[model samples]
Target: MDEMAHKYAHILVAVDGSDGAEVALNKAIESVKHSQGATLDILRVLDLNSLEYGGAGIALDGERIYKIEQANEDYMLKLKERLLKDNEIEHDALRVHLRFGNPKIVILDFQKEYQNDLIIVGSTGKNFIERLVVGSVASYIIRNANCDVLMARTAVNKSK
Candidate 1:
């Protein structure tokens, strides 16, 4: 057990089903494993802005929304299983949460509620043009989060 890992009693990780996120998740699991009694919170925020709009500028229909929500839930479940299988951490030490809204906002709110000592998030490595149009959630979190932020840089981003 390293001293750095023991510094955080509560760790919050934001996962968006991306490879970078998987890296961050793995780091969070390792930190929790090394830190006795530390808990890990896995948060998946469904970015409403990514959803398709209807003819009148309204959001997708209820049925479509329901299906998307169900799919996201299933993905989270599978993610949890993978985390457990890949690591030796106890199931009770991990907590999973799903929310519908802007990811940056939801993550900030969760951090406030949980009072996490550390926040682990994956860098998406979006190009300048894409970031200008869509905005970068990781950038926003790094600037706004109250706790320590760990940006996991994926191998793909390292080559660039």
Candidate 2:
């Protein structure tokens, strides 16, 4: 970031392995470039509440939970590595969080801890039925965040 202009010093991006998320990340990177030294937080939430463990009453086994958590950590590590290799972001400028909970609530609550000035999320990852039933994460974040929010859509490729 330039010394005097930093419209968004900190940005929070939520991803869910969707095409929209990929675009959102791309947009976040683009925004960070203009903001200069803005730090980014990438959050991925696993919906453990919907897990099927022998019906509904049975608890999810400890070992299974452990493995899932490990997988999430591995994915985060790979993401960090990819970002460091591809972007202008320094290793310390990017932070990844893999949390298990309702995405809407987790994302909303997470930004409070980071003092983020901007929040970027995919426009809609879920289909019509799912979104109708549970509501979309992007909609929730846009409505609830205390800071500026962006509902990122598909990427637009520019040619020279």
Query: Which candidate achieves the best TM-score against the true structure?
Result: 1
Candidate 1 per-residue C-alpha lDDT over 25-96 given as tens digits, one digit per residue, 9 for 90 to 100: 878888999998999999999977676666546778789888888998898888788888888888988888
lDDT of each: 0.87, 0.84
Model 1 lDDT, full chain set: 0.87
Tens-place lDDT digits, model 2, residues 1-160? 3531367888989888888898888888777766666788999898888778788887888898998889889998899898878888777778899988998898888899888888988878678999999998898888889998887787567442
Q: Whole-model lDDT, candidate 2?
A: 0.84
Q: Which candidate wins on lDDT?
A: 1
Give each model a TM-score: 0.88, 0.87
Error of 2 at 112 (Å): 0.4
Runs of candidate 2 with Cα error greater than 4 angstroms are 1-5, 52-59, 155-160
